[model samples]
Target chain A: MIDLSQTISSNTIVYTLDMVGVAACTIAATILAKRLQFDVLGAFFVSFLGSVGGGTLRDLLLNRHPIFWLHDLNYIHFIIGLSLIVQIFYHYVERLDKALRWFDALGLAAFTVIGVESALSRNMSAPIVMLMGVFTAIIGGVFRDIVCRQIPLVLQKEIYITASLVGSVYYLLLLQTGINEWLRSISTLLLIFSVRMLAVYRGWNLPDITLQPKEKQK
Target chain B: MIDLSQTISSNTIVYTLDMVGVAACTIAATILAKRLQFDVLGAFFVSFLGSVGGGTLRDLLLNRHPIFWLHDLNYIHFIIGLSLIVQIFYHYVERLDKALRWFDALGLAAFTVIGVESALSRNMSAPIVMLMGVFTAIIGGVFRDIVCRQIPLVLQKEIYITASLVGSVYYLLLLQTGINEWLRSISTLLLIFSVRMLAVYRGWNLPDITLQPKEKQK
Candidate 1:
């Protein structure tokens, strides 16, 4: 397994962006937990799961040790502090739904890029890398929805995973062009963020697959 | 990290029991998929998740490499073969629900023991070991339920996780007695199986926690 500590510590920009993603995910989850009438403990639990579930799964799949959150205590401290703040100012937080969605889109883009980078560093296959990217971008929300007993929005005709996949593929192709690394990463992030935001704005959805014909056609 | 390959390979009984547990989980998940009106591919997917989800999470959290299923291809082959067989004989398989529940209980017991043993081999702390045992035994079913868009039974006040936790603690205590390994394992397995079966038969449930009073709620 690749040692990620040095890589994670050396990249200040990536580290900062990753924490922003974590904060966004935690806030979104806390809002959902409130909607579900969960207690503070439940909200905190869901927020933690939402913030770290994806990266944790990715790290585990790649056989990385200590897990990211466990390796860095700041992740836990940040999540707890943010969750408590959200809980304290829930009335104000609830009104930030629209803003939260945009933040979540930003998070999704950042997470996808980070996941792709992590997989590429390990020299994983293209398909695996792309999969890790999508997993990192969306699995946290899936986990939060599951615990809240709701069908995950991404699994329910949303274009969310598609955005992550597109960005990951775009990033991979850009690598071949020998472009500036910073520009490549930023462009991929913007592409994903734009796709996700436009999908939400246009109310775009993937066509649903009907398992059986409704009541036998005449 | 402890190399479990040799330990898993040398223990014929444990290996056989683990496969049996996998088969049982797959069959149960297949039955659930049929109820959910999922297609063949969906059923196969759910079965795979149900059979391996818990163990995968346990291995990942413990930083075990290669993952148990990837380490042994028989797990994949067995799950596919069993799932296909169940799908082919859906009508007949549907009648075996009662039998399947018993098999699942047995599987839960076996998986808990296996997880505890794996953690113990690594010298994990007691709480972590016990938590790993429960995660190995139930997370698969949790994943299956989540994918199917249902509230997981274990999270809905069921005694399922309790049985696994009890069995794990029992196994840990049994080690203190310096008993024969086989006897210790078998007794722990029986304890868990009996607890689960009895809970099902008696309709035992954990008490629900209400956040607020109904009249003053919201």
Candidate 2:
């Protein structure tokens, strides 16, 4: 009997994690778009764009070849598939705000860990990596809100990007202390998820700073 | 009197054109944002973003040092100045929609030429240069439209990016034929502006291709 051996690349694992996170974001974004009375095309735009927009920005900045979906065509197909499901049962998703919130937090946490680790692997400096991680984790939601004609929660000083930033720092500290890789990843995810959830539940928001109206705001 | 002599940088003309193109885009975006009823903050965001966002994206892709604004802080002040002036005279701007449309067309034309030229200078393939031109010219407007909660004209068949693409082709052909550099640039801009104005006046639009309501759209 002949046996075939296969090894999964760490990149593959990271890619899969990103896909899962994006799927969760897509579902949440579709629900939000519907609640806002976005048309069908608007819902699809919100979902797909909010899901992949950040990673696309990251890839463009890095000059990476074949953007994530362009590479794994399946990822695009997956989003399309998920969008259809949401479209079919729009009422059901609208009624599950609590579930969607939990899923969003989870997805945000997962993407934070994944983005920070990916940047680290590419040898980006800590500050840059942290920014990229946080941006990757939450810029999608910001973009969605912007397109929905609303102020982005991130800009308004919610504890959004801060949670991702803190989680990334924790991951780096663990790496410095020689913690097991698996443990560090889990810890980072938990750290981000808990901080974000607690912030939402406890009404903990970042202090909003005025930009001084340097240009004579009207 | 102290001598104020300075050595002219070899690439002064090239860099000057690039900045000029960016400034034009900034002014046009500010006008559009105003017409759309964006407050001072929103207008500033759209103006500054349209001006710097394209070059920033290009520099990031090339991993160049000192993003354009970082190297020359004047742009920050320039945008502030423009925003202040516009806000104070908001009434005048609102009365100049016809002039603003022409400025918008000019900005689009200028950015299209600059984008393709820069990519070509960097030794990118023609197709890549073409794509860059289209992206640089249209992305800012698309972003502005999206943020205003309006469907982006380019994403539809607005004949926007297509005009830029055609202009890029004309510029490349002019270069291939060894036409005068000034003529090449002017013709390219003229071609695009004329085409865009004609399209807008005639209500010309690209036919919308259905992605089909099947389980696939991403």
Candidate 3:
């Protein structure tokens, strides 16, 4: 006899949200592949890597078996389907570069919250958890950009990583206040998304940390 | 009282080999960072990634906790020390590019065997094990190259990926034959190293598989 009244757990919800982030990031990778004029296989490879890279690292660090994607085919299907759709509609995607940034920001936020919660669940220290959150939020895109031979936006003169760091730390602080779990997660997501979007809008960026003299600057 | 005579297993040997590989790859990464003219911090970051990226991914996929490096500070110390040495001897390294390739090949071989054995211990399928081995063999360099904004040599015209796949598959076949374990492992290491070196000497490479027409190819 199956228990019919069991509520879905927060872990499950976070997993679902992470998948959504993966899907969005996969789409972004596909678009980047198109821009790079990669072949179909290269495009698919980059998309898959972008979708799963961060979460895979998280699961590995946490010692989760089979990895998230390996346990189910849905993530793979989503990535492939989304990649194909993007390939067919790349012209439209070019016009929606702004929307792409928003989608990526949404993924970043969702991933950050999910990463934070997962690390917290594992009883990792707060700073480590927060950094894991930031790593999760940014590494997938970093992988994609690197594979495509572009400087990762996270390492560029941008506020992307800073936004993730702040959001994750904020979420951890909220957790200590005994707030409603769902509310706290939602707030974290919003905080990251909003900060990233504002950074994009306001052209916010960290000063260059290059060690070379002015003539050697790129 | 702790038992004094329980001999260190093959696992320990492979792990030590993997660490040696890590050190070699770290030096390679530091050299690459220098050629890229990264700052000191950037050089260290790249070196650390090259040292641990492959093993980290393998551990993650196999659900190993705390990761190998996290469990021991020695890996961290080795990376830092190697990075400093390479930084101080950057000019000497420039004159020894040939030696760098040899060290890299040795790392590739050792990492491949370790990765293969780890996956096999987890009862992964043969194909998956081989692929994981290849991933472990090449991914660190792939990462270092990608982060430095160079095309990953694995995906470039190099014969790198082929050698890994061959070495791993060969090692697995040897295991199935119930051969002496140390002999099997050492042979696999030698095979990969030899293949890679020969490919370099012979100027062997896979043909480009660009999907674009001649005029559009890069």
Off by over 4 Å in 1: A1-48, A58-63, A69-139, A146-218, B1-10, B36-42, B211-218
In candidate 2, which residue ranges exceed 4 Å CA deviation?
Answer: A1-8, A22-106, A118-133, A153-218, B1-53, B65-96, B123-131, B138-191, B204-218
Per residue, candidate 2 scores C-alpha lDDT tens digits across A37-68 of 55454565577668887877777766664455
TM-score of chain B of 2: 0.79
**Candidate 1: residue B128 Cα off by (Å):** 3.2
| CAPRI class of candidate 2 | incorrect
Q: Mind listing the fnat for each candidate?
A: 0.18, 0.07, 0.25
Question: Tens digit of lDDT per residue, candidate 1, span A1-218?
Answer: 87577456548657877898899999999888777765555566678789899998899789777777654768867887898788777777777789988999999999998899989988999999999999998999888887888778887777899999999999999989978667777899899999999999999887766676777743
lDDT of 2 by residue, B1-218 (tens): 64323223324534565566566666667777877878888889988877777766655644455776797887788877876687678788768778776777777787788778777766766766775686677666666666556655454445677678789988888878967666777788889999988888898765432233435444
State the local distance difference test value for candidate 1: 0.84
Preferred candidate (TM-score higher): 2 or 3: 3
Q: Judge the docking of candidate 3 as incorrect, acceptable, medium or high.
A: incorrect
Question: Per-residue lDDT tens digits of candidate 3, residues A1-218?
Answer: 65333235555667777877987898888878777666454566688889888878787777666786665667767887888778776666667887888988889899898888778878999888988898788888877876877778688778888888989889878977978777788888889899999999999988866689888866
Q: Which model scores highest in lDDT?
A: 1
Ranking by TM-score: 1, 3, 2
Error of 3 at A102 (Å): 17
lDDT per model vs. reference? 0.84, 0.73, 0.80
- lDDT comparison, 2 vs 3, better candidate: 3
Backbone Cα, N, C clashes tallied per candidate = 0, 0, 1
Q: Which ten residues in a row have the lowest lDDT in candidate 3 chain A?
A: A2-11
